[model samples]
Target chain A: MKKLFKFEFRKLLHSKSFYIIFGLGLLSIILFMILGRVMSDFVGDSSEMYNATATMLVVLPNSGIASLLGTYLVLFACSDFSQHTIKNIYARGYSRTSVYFIKYLLSLAATLTVAIFYVLFGFVFTLVLGGHVASIASYMWANLALQFLVLVGMHGMFFGVAMICNKTGVGIIVNVVGIELIFTLLNFLMQIAKIEFNILDYYLEMILANLMNSQQLTTAALVRAIVMPIVYAVGFVTAGWFVNRRREV
Target chain B: MKVMIENFQTNNVVETENLTKVYGQKTVLDHVNMHVAKGDIYGFIGKNGAGKTTLMKLLLGMAQPTEGQMKLFSNGNLNAERHRVGALIEAPAFYGNCSAVENMKRFAILAGADDNEINDILQFVGLGDVGKKHVSKFSLGMKQRLGIALAMLGKPELLILDEPINGLDPEGIKEIRDLLLRLNREQGVTVLVSSHLLDELAKITTRYGIINQGRLVEEVSATELMQRCQQKLHVITDQPAVAAKVIKKLSPKAVITANENSIDVVGITVDSAKVTKELVKNEVAVQDITFAADNMEDYFIQRMGGKA
Candidate 1:
């Protein structure tokens, strides 16, 4: 298990696609920060509100989380199937369960790695840009932690999708299409049943999209942020593992 | 010349009992019982989509058999016993963007081979001086060599290769044939290889298993298949007339025909040793003895029931 895990992690670490996605993510961060800075000059906002550090922590994810996360999931989670490398790994005596976990865990690690690099890069760039670092960015640890769970949870949903698709091009198309319709899938169910409850708030996409905006950190919201994402992570992982175990590849 | 028959012990390296695979409504494999002994270059012959790759998948643990059982290294515990097996099924699959060295290193680690084994394996496959060239830049033959290199890792006792010489030139095919022969001769490794080039397979194979439409029609050794395909024995001697008379005496019921220095003995298997002895007694020196064998492709096609 450890050998397979290390091999899987190294595969992504050495891949060109991983680095390309990381560049796109960094570009999204830099572009959003510059755009926010230019708009602040005309909106008459103070420097403290649109500070670089604050943008780094809060806006980094919200700006490009969907596309960036989708691309990562599409490439890493299922590209091996199209390359047929997973068949080689299986022929080498690794079990189906072990391969599944290695891929899933490495996907999680890659998401965290890119997210941390963006945050740190934004922090350093604020200093170089001669912008005052806001104290609120330092105290935004709770929101940051919540957003991390939201990201992981969102990854779990796409991880399942990628596993079932098992083709990179199809995975990309399905992931992009799934993200577009996922928010309203449950709402459609609720409206057809004539139910008044808005179940969309509990979905991974909804929670992640609204994570930094609703910074109340209420007890119910805290439980929802913590419990909902973990459930999706566990639920989707279990489902995907079974799907992989029965597959011929 | 053929392999020494004594080395072929009954210790089966690979055995399948009534194995079957069904995909949807189509039955891909139907009750195949394959036997590969310890020192055999077992050539599995079949046309496209004839369950050659499916059987390989089951042996590699890449797919579950729908019915029946398979044993590797004579052990029923396939997962544990599979560690002793290596394979190159269909095309070589690798991270195309990575260098050949990097790709080999990655699979070597996963296969539990020592890092020191890398250079030796790459050199064995004639890819020693690639110098960090990416696999995506490699030609089809180079990629096939890399795939073979990957299979040679971890000291596998049994190698299962499917269509290994598909894209190679004639020289490359001969090189691979020599490699397999060397491995079987020097290391006593058992090889299960499939190829469309029946002539190449006939040169190296010690045994054959012909499959047609998901059924294993036959499993026979090279010597036995040759005997079944023999047309007549041709003998060369100093005096063809005397040799023909001697061969006629050895097999009276056979038809003997002679040319300037050679005699053809048809319709029977004669004692060539006795004929050689009698020819020497008659002062007609025996030079060479051989049999006109049938084309291996025709024989295999017949074994496959004229399917391909």
Candidate 2:
């Protein structure tokens, strides 16, 4: 199992697409930043959104991280199936369960690594755009940690979709765009009806939004933050593992 | 059961009893009892969709057996014993975007082989010089060689290769044939190979297992299959050199080769009595003559035709 993990991790690291995904994300950000700079030339940088913390808030979700990360996770997980390389692994005597979980652990590590990089870049861009850092706060650190968890939780969803669908073409569509569209529609409908009691509070997407946008963390928000992502991480991974194990090579 | 397991541990590298696999509404493999003995290049012959890949998949644990038992180099511990096996079933499975060495490195790690073994394996399969080339750009033959390189890792005790030489040129085929022969001869590797090319299979296989419609119809040694499939007449004589001269004079186009004690005449139209008479008329002194099927492809076609 350790060897399997090392080999998979090595493959992931060696993948040019892995770094390309990150580069593309950064390129899009650069282009968007230039547009924002041009727009600010007339408006004169009066807004408070250019600060380090506020820039992170505006860019992390909107920076194409969600979609990019979603697509990358699906691509990574389904490459074994899409390329049929899993046959080699299984033929080498590694159990299906071991392969599934090793891939899961690798995906988890990837999510956390991307999340850290995104946050760091968001801060770096604030300085690039000539904004000052905000005063450090304990609650802010907690919020950042919770948001990273939310990213991982979402990564789990993408991983699950990839494993269950077992093909890059279909899995990427479903996870990166399809599932998010469904959640967005659900949120839209809830608003049109003006329903007070929200069922989506326990969902990762909703929790991620609430954590990213909330000014102060409430007890209910804290509980949802802790419980929802864990559920997504564990629940999705378990489902993916089961589906992958029973799946034919 | 214990006795059978012990017997196979020494005598056979693979033994399966009543091994069956069924899809949603169709049975792909129906109760096959296969045995691949040690040091055997076992040829698994079958037409496409005739369950050759299905049986290979079942042996490698890529698919579950609906009803059966298989022992691989040991008793019941399939996972442990599977460590001694290397298989490449169906189309070459690989990361196309990665270089051959990178892909080899990836699988070699999983296969418990040292990174140093990668160069030697690639060289053996003729991919050593082009190790840095991405597999996507590779021709079908190159990819096939890469697949073989992957299967040859870890010095496995047994190899299960299905149609491994699909897209190779004649020279490539000969190279792979020599490679398989050398591996078997030098390291005592037991190989179970399935190929649509019966003639090519005939060249390297030590024994044969013929499959028709998910059933192993026959298991015979190479010599036995040749004797069974061959229709050429072997004319034993006191002077084989003289017999060859007379046969060449009798028919210029006839493939007549002289053995130490006999002249093998390969042709369907050659009558034994006519050859015997010709050899005797030339004072060649014919002692005996016999005829049988002379082509593996012809025999296989007959077999498959009979099954059909």
Candidate 3:
């Protein structure tokens, strides 16, 4: 099992797409850091007033981090077919169960790493920019964790669809069209119906919105946000395993 | 007890009874039956789209047979026995980001290999030096080598390889052929190989089952088929017509077909001295007498009726 994990890690690290996504995220962090420093130099510190203005600037763009995590998920799940490497993995002694879980674990690990860095960098930048850190850390962590779980779970759905289709293109299309566009639209309908369906909302986005503004949100909304994504992640991964095992190679 | 005893007697390494597969209206495999013995290098020979790949896929548990029953190693337990077998269904593809060792390790886990055996298996396939360097950087031949290495992992007793030597240069072909022979002869691994290269397969196979139109036409040991597919000996002599006349009386079953100055005697056991004596007795000045037998290519072409 350790050997299998090691192999999966090595493959993920060595992938050009992995490096590409990481590089893009790293570049964005650097750009934000430079921008924050320049803004602080221009508008002298008003720390005596203890304003939340700088915190807003730093954390608002963390949503871009979510999009970055999303893109990474897309590429990582699709790379098996894009590179035509699934057969190699299948022929090896690892069960399909292990393969499915390993992919999920790697994607989750990646999302967590990026999410943590995004929050940490945003907080440190805001402090240097002469603004109070606020109670954003706890909320940011909560929001990022929810998004990571959801993204990882969504990636599981992508992985499952890819296994069933045995082609990367179909997986990409399903995620882009079905999950991003179609499901998002369905989520809109649920919201408009006023049927008391808060779970279908963009939980990460809502939490990020509350975090940036330092607003006190309802526990019911927060609980729905956290629990729904975990369900998606677990449900998608289980379905993927079942489909992969039963489907002919 | 009678039923249990009957089951024990049918212990073939691979058996398919009336296995059929159809893609829409076209039938790729039509009720094909195959039986391969344990520890046999069963060479599967056929033309393109002859269902060799389909048969291999069925045995490897990659694709379901549309009709009929498929069994492996005396039981219908393909998935349970899959760990004991390794297969390469088509052109071996590997993850570009992984090194040869890393790729092997991933498959080793999937195939259920112990931790200590990964390095040994990599070395067996000549990828021992593949450290840190990703498979993307390896040559095509190297990838194919890694594929075989992965297949040999877990010390799998049964190996199913599809076109194992395809895209390989002459040296590459020889290397793989030697490796396979070693695996079979030294380790007692049973191999089922499918190839369009009949001559190459003829060199190392223990037994061959020729498939045409998705059906097996014949199954015989290589040694048994060698007499019928041996190398042809062409005899060129002065007074070819007179030499042929005398040689005909000696080897009655010999084929007396002529080229320019040579008479071709196919499928016959001929002694050079005996042919010389007979030609001289007929007053035919003997210069040189050559004898030739049918090679594997000739036999394949003749057997396949010159079909592509």
Candidate 4:
């Protein structure tokens, strides 16, 4: 299993798509930082604007990290199918379950790596631009932890879609349209119906928003934030594994 | 029944009994019973969509058989013994953007082969100088060679190659043929290669399994096939039954088919003079005699019920 993991991770790490996505992510962050600086200047009162900019950095994980990592995982997971390289693994006696699990673990690691790079660079850029770092230190660590879970949960869903679909175009559509548009539409309908609890909040994006925007994390909210994403991660990954095991490829 | 049976030893590298594969309403492979002996270059002959690839897939555990059993290396547990076998079911599958060595290294790792052996495998497949050239940039022949290199990674005991020499030049074909021969002769590796190039397959194969419409029509050895297809004397005689009896006495193993006006004597190593003498001794009169032989293509055509 360790050998399989190392081989799979190396394949992911050396892929041209990995470098392309990583570079584009860095460039986008740089552009956002520059835009933040310009907005602060135009709004006047540098210290107040700097605090706002730092708050924006904290909130960046909510949307930016999940979508970027989700897109990458969707593409990465479907590539083996498109290229037919998965045959090599199975033909060499690796179990389909092991292959699916390793790919999931690698996707998680890739998401973490990209997220860490984004945060480190965002922090350094904020300091260089003289933005005052916000002091929500008490809950900041917990927020970051919750954000990590959200990333995992989102990637798990995308990975499952990629494996089940086994086609690049279908995977991308499921990740972008199926998850984003349909789920958001469902959430909006629930709100219009005046439902007290939005069931979609148990999913990745809603849980991420709740974690990032809530001023004081309640015990129930905290439990949901931690437990829901883990559930999503495990449930989707297990589903992907099951499908992979039965799949002919 | 003319199928080849060279080595009479009890060891069989691959054996399948009534193995079937069904896709939706279509049965792609139906009750295929195939046998491949150890150290034999078993040629799997079939036309397109004749279930050749499907059988290889079942043997490799890439797809499960709908019914029946397949034993590899004397074990029916394919998941456990599949590591001892290496296969290329169709066109070589790899990360086209990665170099040949890189692709091999990845498979080698999965195959539990030492990383250091990648270079040797690449060299063996005649892709030694393909350094750093990504597989996407490779020619069809190069891609095929790299696929072979990938299969040879762990020094597997059994090799299942599907249309391996399809896109090769004559020289490339010869090279691969020699390579397969070397592997079989020197390393004792059993090969099950499927190809439409019957002539090329005839050159190196020790045994053959002919499949048609998802059914195994025949399995033959090189020597037995040669004997079955060898030139024979066709004698037109006034008394074919009497002539046949006379010839059978001289060449007991001769395959003789007696018609009203003729007796076709096949697989017999006797001269026409001896046959005539024996017939005269039996008081059977022969009017005419002719010689004929069938090449592998003709034999295959005849076996498949086509006009040969």
Candidate 5:
């Protein structure tokens, strides 16, 4: 199993698309910084620019990390099927369960790596733009934990979808259009409806928002943010493993 | 139970008992009972979509049998013994973006092979100089050789290759054939290769299992196939009965078939001088004489009901 994990990680690191998507995530931060400078100059309000920069860093969990990781996992996971290399793995006596689990862990690790890079870039941009970093630092640890869980949940969902579809184009559509776009839209509707209870708290973006705002870090919120993503991660991976075992490849 | 023990004691590398695979309403492999012996170059012959790949997939445990059992290395535990088998089913599958050596290194790690063995196997398959060229840039024949190289890793006891020469030129086909033959001869590796090119397969295989429409029509040794496809002396005469009687008198055990206008002497080395002299002496005039030798293609066509 260690051998399989190492081999899969090597393949992921060697993939051109993985680096391309990761570069895109970093590029988005630089682009956001540039856009803030131009907007501040035009509006003659430096405070607006600082607020936008802080918002970008705050929402990096959902917009930058989750979306980019979702796209990357879709492309990376489906390559095994599209390229037919899954046969080589199975032919070597590795079970489908081990393959799926290793892939899941790899996706999580890759997402965490990219997310860290995004945070580093965000910090540098804040310093370069002359904005105080103290506001972002207070919630940084909490938000980082929340982002990690969100990524775990997101990776699990995308991994399951890609494994089930086993086609690159279909995987991309389901992850980007089906899961991300549709779930975000549903969460927006819940906000508009002004529901008393936060039923959509389990949704990835909602979890990110609540974790970013909660100052006390209560037990119930911790369960919702931490334990729920773990449940999503475990549930989706188990289902994907089951489906993958029976697939003909 | 007795039959199981008997098969286990023998040198069979692969044995399937009434194995069947069904996809939806169609049956891909129907009750396929096949045996590949140790150190035998077993050629699995079939046409396209004839369940050749399906059987290989089943033996590799890539797919489960719908109705029966498969034993590899005489063991019923497929998972434990599968590491001793290496297979390339349908096409050569590899990480296209990775270099040939990189792809091989990954497989070596999975197969528990030492990293040093990678270069040796690559050179063995004629891909030594591929260097850092990714597999996506490789030609079809080059990719096929890499696939063979991957399968040859870990020095597996059995190698199952399906249509390894599908898109290769004549030279490429000959190279693969020679490699397989050398592996079987020098390393004593049991090989089960499937191909539609009967003539190419005939040159290297020691035993053959001919499949038609998901059924194993026949399984015979190369020597037996040669005997079955032996040349016959066809004598065309106006009076075949007289020709048969005259030829029968000389060689009493000769297999003479008297047709409408010709007599076929099966499995007999007819000395033209002696047979002609005997026919002239018997007042029989031979209008035409020809040797009809059946090649592998002709035999395959005949076995498959002329479908080939």
Candidate 6:
């Protein structure tokens, strides 16, 4: 077991894709920070509110939060199959279960790292520009962490899709198509079902809106968000491993 | 000179009992019963689509046999043997971004390699110097070498390689050949190498199994195969009628297959020079003369009802 874990981690660390993804995380974090600082309005007493709004808008729309997060996480998860390196991973004698789990953990770690980095830089930028550091810092941290959970969950959903469509090209196409078509389709369905949850538009849109609003997360809401992603991750991972083990390579 | 079956030890490292693999209506492997000795270098030789890879996969537990049983033995317990087997089937693919050393490190860990054994095996396959260099830049031969290095990491008693030298150059092939030999001879590793290169297989293999279409036609020792190929010499002469008369009178057991002017004669013991001299003395024209025992390739062709 120890040997297999070391092997998994070693492969993950040595992969060029891993480095590329990590670098992309860092670059995007910096890009978000710069955007936050430039667009921030520091006028009179309302300067803190303006800075907070600017940071929320920049992070949520472009970097720290929603649509961008989903894309990055999905891309990172699918890159393994895209490059056709899954065979290499399994041929090393590690079980399919272990491979998928390790990849899940690695992607989680990377996403969290990016989330934390973006929040840290956002703090430094806000302070230098004469914004309310204490009032907004906590919100920023909480929002960033919540956003991280959502990103993790979104990754799980994407991972399931990846397994369902094993080919990288198909996975990408499905995700892009899902993003473009699902929102409207879900909205229409929600009206027909008379459901108030508004899940269709809430997937990426709600996450984006919350980032900009600095809305406090209720315990139930937080649990629902966290648990929903876990369900997707576990379900997809099981199916993926099952399909992988049974299919002839 | 066949492999003596009764005298062979019963402690088999790998045994397949009536293994069958079918793809829909077309059977790829039909009831293959293979028993690889604990310390034998079993060479699996066959033409394309001979189910060599399928057999290897079944043995490795990568693919389940459609209908059969495969058992591994270790210390008289089958379960213990599962952890001891190591294999590399098809091409060895690695994460292109990682270095060779890193790839080995990963495989060594998963293969249950000890701390020192990891680096030792890397050096064994000549990938130690490729320390930080990513695997993407490594050539095909290098990847194969690394693959072997990974397979050898745990020092498995059973090593299975399928078409291992597919893309290697002459020097690379020679290097791998020597490495395999040393591993088997010095380390007591039982190897199962499947290849189409008969000459190369004939060099280091201790045992041979010939498969055709989906059935294993023959399984014999290397010594027995070499001996069987030495059955008789073939002679080609310019004058058919005269050469036939001379060969029949000299060696009654000899058979002749003649064309318009060229003739093929088998079963004569005389040297080529002596036979040529005798044919000329008898007024038979000798256009070109060549005599040698049939090789494994020839024997395979003959067994498959094809002239070689």
Error of 5 at B92 (Å): 1.1
Q: Can you write out model 3's per-residue Cα lDDT over B80-122, one digit (the tens) per residue?
A: 6766788877878667766777676666666667657888877
**Superposition error at A157 for model 5 (Å):** 1.2
The lDDT per prediction is 0.81, 0.81, 0.69, 0.81, 0.81, 0.67
Window of ten residues with lowest summed lDDT in model 6 chain A? A41-50
DockQ-derived CAPRI band for the predicted complex in model 1:
medium
lDDT string for model 4 (B152-237, tens) is 88889999999999799999999999999999999999999999898999999999898888899999999999877888889998
> What is the TM-score of model 2 when looking only at chain B?
0.78
lDDT of 5 at B234: 87
Worst 10 residues of 1 chain B by lDDT: B1-10
Residue pairs clashing, model 4:
B3-B220, B4-B220, B4-B221
Which pairs of residues collide in candidate 6?
A3-B109
* TM-score, first chain, each model: 0.88, 0.85, 0.71, 0.86, 0.80, 0.70
Off by over 4 Å in 1: A47-56, A131-139, A185-195, A214-220, B1-10, B114-116, B232-249, B252-295
- The alpha-carbon lDDT assigned to residue A97 of candidate 2 equals 91
Cα lDDT tens digits, model 3, A100-215, are 77877877776667655665666565566555745535665555555555555555555555555555556656654555566567677877896566443544444444434334
Model 3: native contacts recovered, as a fraction: 0.38
The single-chain TM-score for chain B of candidate 3 is: 0.78
The segments of candidate 2 whose C-alpha lies over 4 angstroms from its true place after superposition are: A27-59, A128-134, A187-203, A216-218, B1-5, B230-295, B305-308
* Candidate 1 residue pairs in backbone clash: none
The digit string of per-residue lDDT tens for model 1 on A57-101 reads: 565554576676777787888877878988788887788988888
- Cα displacement (angstroms), candidate 3, residue A31, comes to 4.1
Model 1 global lDDT (CA atoms, 0 to 1): 0.81
Q: iRMS for model 2? A: 0.9
Best by DockQ: 4
